[model samples]
Target: MAGAGGSSWVPWYEHASPVLYLEQLLGNVLKEVDMPLEERDAKLKFADRLQSLTQKAILKEYPNTHTNVALRGFGSFASGFALKGSDMDMVLMINGPDKEKLNFKDIANALKQSFKADGLGVYIISNTRVPIIKICEKPPAWFWEEQEKLETQAAVEASAFKAGDGKNVVGDGANNSETSHSMTNAGVSGEHSSESEAEDEEEKEARLRRKRVTEMANKTNAPKNSKVWYRERKLGKSDFPKSDAGILCDINMDNPMGLENTHLLRCYAACDVRVHPMATFVKAWASRRKINSSRDGTLSSYGYVLMVIHFLVHIIQPPVLPNLQHPQDWPGLQDLLHDEQSQFFADAINGHWIHYVRNVDALNYYGSKNISPNTMPVGRLLTEFFSYYGDPISGGHSWQGHVISLRTRHGGVLDKGEMGWNRATSEMVNGIEVRQRYLLAIEDPFETNHNVGRTVTNEGAGVMRREFKRAVSILRGMIGRGTPREDLMEEWVDKVVVDEGGQGEGNVGRGPVATDGPLSITASLARIGM
Candidate 1:
């Protein structure tokens, strides 16, 4: 991993720090909690396939509409912080002259019918602010077989080309064509040993190499027996299909802001290497603690991401990241301002100015150029993050009257009263009484009027705060202790008990907290005079 200025990252233990053990423990915990490479690859491939299929379905179903339709992915998957089995969020963008006349409900119904006709299970939800088409289905047996076959063929061709015998191979086309069709027709069959014994030693080695590559590709592309491959492993409820489907996709039509926000986050993630891992760790912690679901009246994953960004860019001393939305802070803005077509300038979208610095690479080493660059390791950053949010006595963030705002120049902190969101208000929405609370206000960077934490209910806010405090107490207790990394990891990430008897459904119970010895988490907190 590279640090802020693209230098090799120094490990936490290399620093002359007192919390070396804690840093090592947290580093190991991040590794354990992160998604595996294989799983991430499979999920991304599934998403690509689904996007292709959906695009084809739209074109086929609306042949006479003359509309240019495109599907774009957004949210965590696009922002590079997606956990294992995270749902793929996409927008079905329709262009052309008649696009303004199109009805979302009608379009969703048409797409649902088209997907069902193609033997896929789909649901259309039209009552929400933005209509959604939920698609879930296992790829047919032929689909998996074809995928494996194509991957195997490509691997063999790659191996053959690398072995330096491209001329001798007849009509293989592996030397000339990179297309999948050319590779498939390269005269390589499923059987690997069909070559004659009279072949030279070099050819034999190439054949053996091809066979090994093919086997590995087949293993990776083969479909697994498990159904609902995208469901979370630990907590929360997933409405995704429980059958042998390998992916779940949510398609919407009216959320271009989501795509913009995803790009904004991607740029922020590109600023520093520590940003992604820290955000992922915090998100996993929130999910495990049962406070990550917006539908269940808590903060969404996007809100947590904003919180992490706020901490890194504004709250932390000698910020680990620059506010990409702040044009004055970015030196590259001068060039972009002269370019009329540059997206770096704000666009008037839905009565809001949606803008951010899109060319992240141009502002090279902006983080490290600060008067006092933050050279803290990911472990130290994470520790400070927990302290800032959880331990109020440590002179950290106080969520009572303040709001989290990433767009602000003043430390990402805003007064709730100044924003006119000081108290809870109830309004009628679609004939139902809807309540909006400012308990945990988080202003969206672009859509400044939208509070990302409006879904957090009073009880949900309490639960989240409690979890935050618990994390702070436990981490404090475990710091400097010679506890095994595995034990510390389990205590932090895996040791959670669901409070079924609590007022809310997925409330977390306070179990044994972090301690190297026999003392409980509560006892450790008492020992530290918390």
Candidate 2:
């Protein structure tokens, strides 16, 4: 709403509509951060080609086996929050009973060889918590591979339907029994033809006679239920052999639930129109502030996403997001909480409580039924988000003492103790040490035992809070004062200097303050109820 009219700027809040300002702000932010559709599509195509090559190489190395090698997209690529040039996170799922015999080192070696042969730069980093192979860019033959794939698909489709005199057979008899038998042998045929039709007429007739004799004997020997026999035959010739145990036994691994989390975020975005822009703006802000990297002792992108969700769900005046995972009407949730695993006390004798709730359909729908649609201006929400989390110590307590949990509705806060989190104690689950960090506590929506905020250190959290406050101040100043839109928009991120318990704390009109403004620091503070 603070548009420049003939070089004279307008105050944002006093403008015709606050939503207009939010729309403009989001448009500007997205123009800077969002990847173009064409570029995103090209990158995805490159990833698919690279994955195909890797799969072919692995299969070649371990030939004549039931090894099912595939590259599954994860992380931001699968999630909707990917930026331009964001590295794709892919997981190699080697499915099959014999997959246990395949060594991860061998797989890595095969990937290395494939990348080398293609003349692409690749790094096989297997030392980390989750092993990954980093690829520089798409290979030179990527376009060629795409073209070849298209041609091969066309040929396959053409071959699937061919001219026949009167009667026709469909698919190779070995692999197409189910559909082949179901189809009529008239002029209409399937996309695939039977391989046995290529044999000499005499040999085919002889084989048919032998099959009839065998069927007669088997029918007499078989049980009364013919459907069971058909079902067995239908499922018998699966490509991947079954293991003795029910489990896949491929590396005896834990499921990568990251894909599920990605789906959850995608649903949230689809349900609300405002979530994506808000998330993107926060990501850009975090990137500018240099507090977004986990390696730098701060939060990861996922951490930032969780933070945004927390604000939208709990901090807003009328909650923008519903407590999907632990809604008040969620069935069996009350009884689930009474279970021993959800109850954790220091001296409890049974076991350490690990809160793990799987509410699959909670995020299935996004529109608000509990509360009205939160149509608050995005700009105001952004300011409030920063203000709420910016202050390290507010209301006579630090953020470390509180927990940001979706389980508690009505914008509620759950203490760390009741949530089975403590800094003084550590527990071992499945040979991995689980320790709680009191710096910041963010309960995982599904896996309650896991604190997503554990990655944030004490100093790192303080820095982030300070940055948030600084952002709030700058944005507030830009809106309150009739600052030249261009001047405030330009290099605004660079102007927020981190205060080290020194001067410039609440010192208005200091670095990037507008020269003329009606609003004051006191007014901004009052807005946030500080």
Candidate 3:
């Protein structure tokens, strides 16, 4: 019931519905992200600010223009309402056929200056990278679900999942079968199968699961009798949407597997807000460029950390050799070619896992410290991977060679932060209008490792993934039915693994030493005396 659901509005500009009219109120809506309490009056007063900020962003870029750009949807989390925290997220779109390059970053930057605040993000068409900006004044808290509830004014809307009959192929069973016969009102059909089922079985199961999840999206009686609408049926599901690569956040938060990392990222977008550039950057890059529109940059696509895990788990861990001496491994090239896990890794990492991790992590996770260049971000991950592959000290690295790794990494750059180059106006910052460097320091598992302007920190990101997965699993299992709503980061932080010495620094040796560099598989083996 909450969310755009299936109601595709034809942009206000398309219909020219001038229903509500009175006085044009305007100002920064995020002025109260830090505010503790916000009443209705306070929220109504902020609505004008939302209109002004959005309008100013448009006007500053498109001056003397009557051609209104039809807005399709607000940036994720449906920004464009008086959130409980007193913030407003607005979606600005142009529905015309002219595909001229629209720079969302520039517009976002301008808005930061005009509003004299921070914490603003702008995403374009869900295709291009969205830019986040902050406005002056204290604001309140807001979530993506709440936005759908208030804006659509419906408990449930048609799911994009069900909308995928022709374009989207939802298999019949948990294996994702093509022709699914089983049908459940909840949409969950078919019996559970073995995890080691054949491809056909997997496909069948996957399809049924997809439909079931979508059907379940509409029903909301699982929690305290509270109903929540769900969308993005086929897109996928996880604690963190696509990437879902969580580690340990900060040990201080507790629960080594997952705890506080997710909390910090979603907590306050007021004074400090940083995104994992890789997540947002690659997403915007693909969207702006219109690449892989079906799944976009999912874990199977752009999740940097998970990609690394796959390579280690498949290729190097149990390296597919010319012969499987023990019979358990993929012995011949033919077997390797058909290996499911290997294929998954290939589809995810694209052959050279080293090249993929090195380049993407350099940008996404920040590789400038511990043992590599300050210019790149994936500093520690590369060393770990190389070492894992028995080739850490090898100097033969460049982020080139493989095409899959190359394109994925090259696509990781955000052209200089997630800001739009053109089509952006209005600016503001920190309660005063000024310019400041966009720092991508925090780590958020939900975002790309490359995205720097996220609210979650690196420690938090690793743990957030673990927590998100745990939360989803725990809540689902506890009630014997799935409920999308789960605990926040703060709750988990209180239960982190104190043994890791907080921040999950379990003697990893402050990360890698500068002495470590690129080497060969043999050299790595020699060093480890393997």
Where model 2 places Cα greater than 4 Å from the true spot, the runs are 1-23, 138-255, 327-372, 391-398, 407-412, 417-436, 478-480, 484-530
Model 1: how large is the Cα RMSD against the reference? 20.0
Q: Which regions of candidate 3 deviate over 4 angstroms?
A: 1-45, 64-66, 69-83, 97-105, 117-130, 139-530
- Cα RMSD to the true fold for all candidates: 20.0, 26.1, 29.0
Best by TM-score: 1
User: Candidate 1 residues 440-503, lDDT tens each?
Assistant: 8888787786667776654467667776776665666554564433332333332212222233
Tens digit per residue, CA lDDT, model 3, 1-530: 23387776442211211111000000121231222244444543554555566567667776755545432222212211112232222334443333244555565555545543333221111111233232323322332343334224311222444565342222223412212211111110001101001222333344354345334432422212111111112321111122222110100000111111112212211101112222222222222222211111111112232223223223232221111112233222233334443332111111212111111222222212221112222222222233332221232211111111212211212232233321212233222221111212211222223221211222322332332234233323323232224321121101101111123211211221222112212211111000
Ranking by TM-score: 1, 2, 3
Candidate 1 vs candidate 2: the lDDT winner is 1
Please give the distance, in angstroms, between residue 170's alpha carbon in candidate 2 and its true position after superposition. 58
- Rank list by lDDT: 1, 2, 3
Could you tell me how far off, in angstroms, the CA of residue 476 lies in candidate 1 after the best superposition?
Answer: 1.9
* Pairs of residues at least 3 apart in sequence or in different chains that clash in candidate 1: none
